[model samples]
Target: MNLFERLSGVIKEELTSLVNQSIRQEDTPEEEIERTISQMRSKVMATRIAIVRSSASQARLLKKGLVILEEELAQAEAKREALLRRISQANQRLERATRPTQTPFYKLEEKALELEAIAQAADELNWTKKINS
Candidate 1:
């Protein structure tokens, strides 16, 4: 991966090197100037293409990450709603005060809150990523 990025830099440097050598060795200044300008234009265009391609790849990866994040978020939301219903039932049971086996809503509520926190974090991360990409 690093090698691929470094190759772009290497290509740019090679183009500069060749242009400098041509400038020093050519008999006619006009010919050297024209050749160097052509080489520079090609290098600039190639760099732009490379940048666009990298941006496209990053966009694809970010989109895939968002898809996975969305599916996980949907599941988290479903779990939260189920827990809310259970908590409501527990409250109703508390009103009757028939059983003393466990704490009514604390544990389930705890897990629901934890999942909510994780979902929020994932959402923030995804937003930042998408904007940057």
Candidate 2:
């Protein structure tokens, strides 16, 4: 065989060997695609879990706030009732203070005493008998 022909053949054989080795070293496209899909699914699951946890926390906070508001409402109702009772007491006092005397005999007695005292204070006036008459 000629030296040039042998050399060419050897170089061609080396090129074929290198291509096969590269193919063997690299993963198939299908395997790479599956690995990426699996990683994305895991990330999605984690995100879903985080959202659920956040929602639960918010619900708990709202429940606490509602309880606090209800307690405040109860306190306000109690205060209103107390104020109403105090107002009723004050109204009763005002009514008692402003009401007129009901007995005619007591009214006459009071008037007679007032006139007697005034006539006594003024020596020249004789108004007690007039008031009694």
**Leading candidate by lDDT:** 1
Q: Which residues of candidate 2, in runs, are more than 4 Å off? A: 1-54, 106-133
List candidate 1 stretches off by more than 4 Å: 1-54, 97-133
Candidates' C-alpha lDDT = 0.64, 0.59
Q: Listing every candidate in turn, what is its Cα RMSD in Å to the true structure after a full C-alpha superposition? A: 28.6, 36.3
- TM for candidate 2 is 0.36
lDDT for 42 in candidate 2 is 42
lDDT of 2 by residue, 14-131 (tens): 5775576567667765454444444444434433443444456654554554455456555655665676688899999999989976699879998999999887777545466567
Candidate 2 has its poorest 10 consecutive residues by lDDT at 42-51
TM-score of 1: 0.31
Clashing pairs in 2: none
